[model samples]
Target: MEPLNNDMSSIPDRDALPYRDCVGIAVFNRDGNVFIGRRKGSDDPERSADFDAPWQMPQGGIDKGEDPLRAALRELYEETNITAVSLLAEAPEWIYYDLPEDMLGKALKGKYRGQRQRWFAFAFTGDDSEIDVEAPGGGKFHAEFEAWRWERLSRTPGLIVPFKREAYEKVVEAFIDIPQRFTHV
Candidate 1:
């Protein structure tokens, strides 16, 4: 065997992997509690991380030429069937997270390493009857949540998968003042 050369071409470029651009929504009700959903089913084995918490806020990919704010609203309506909302706040910056090693080349159709998310906070003005996770708007995608509820924004980090906890924490911190500004019915 000949001596191995330090050719950079032989090494895979981790930066070459693209991160899917996506958006997340944290819809808050009258009491300032943010919406959370319990994912409908068990892990796909390939895409899911080993975490007990299934609850998370509404999130999805940003379509071609679609604005991040628009994508946030669209994903919110498509996932929760609620539309009566007013913008509360938007995160100061985009948050990025990577998939676990086992899922790196399998999740998201192996198209990207993970997601780069733009998170938005909205005030839910509609009544509870407006929410129907089973049949979302336009019906483009299947129901992602089996059960849903409103939770304290601060507690969200613990309820999400470990890999996504940091992003959730930042979101909560960025919007921490939201409740004080909109406490009225």
Candidate 2:
């Protein structure tokens, strides 16, 4: 993975840029493990690679006027192909993260400085057979992940890109009790 570009001098106006509206989903299975996927490397050669910490929970942009929860469910199904789930919890407030300085103008199509995400946690009630990361949502949505797996929720922060790690940490804190809640169910 490429090192996080720390030079902020080049992107002096980044703070003025708007954050992309988005939703993030954390789907936990019967075992209390959370679902994560290995993000496919960017097709753009100029973008930094994510090989170092490529795993992340399913997330995506929220269309204008879309309800956050609805967007969360849509993104989850679109990215993971698992629709059998029950709402577990929602973060009390939106979590925000900034793109690294180097990514300010290069990521998110150069329109946003970062993402402001509303996160939802759901209990996965379906069998693992329902997962089809290779062609999620029956291929209606573009594939963002190359592979997928179940992982401990506590380990997610360490598995995501550095720029998004803090947001993941807040997510873990918000839903930390989720696993135990489903452990005996």
Candidate 1 regions exceeding 4 Å error are 1-13, 43-49, 138-140
Candidate 1: residue 164 Cα off by (Å): 0.4
The best candidate in terms of TM-score:
2
Which candidate number maximizes lDDT? 2
- Candidate 1 scores a C-alpha RMSD against the true structure in Å of 4.1
Error of 1 at 106 (Å): 1.4
Q: Candidate 1 local accuracy as lDDT?
A: 0.85
Model 2, residue 137: distance off in Å is: 1.6
Please, what's the RMSD in Å of model 2?
5.4
Give the Å error, residue 49, model 2. Answer: 4.2
TM-scores of all models?
0.87, 0.89
Instruction: Output the lDDT of residue 114, model 1.
Output: 81
Q: What are the clashing pairs of model 1?
A: none
Candidate 2 clash figure, as a count: 0
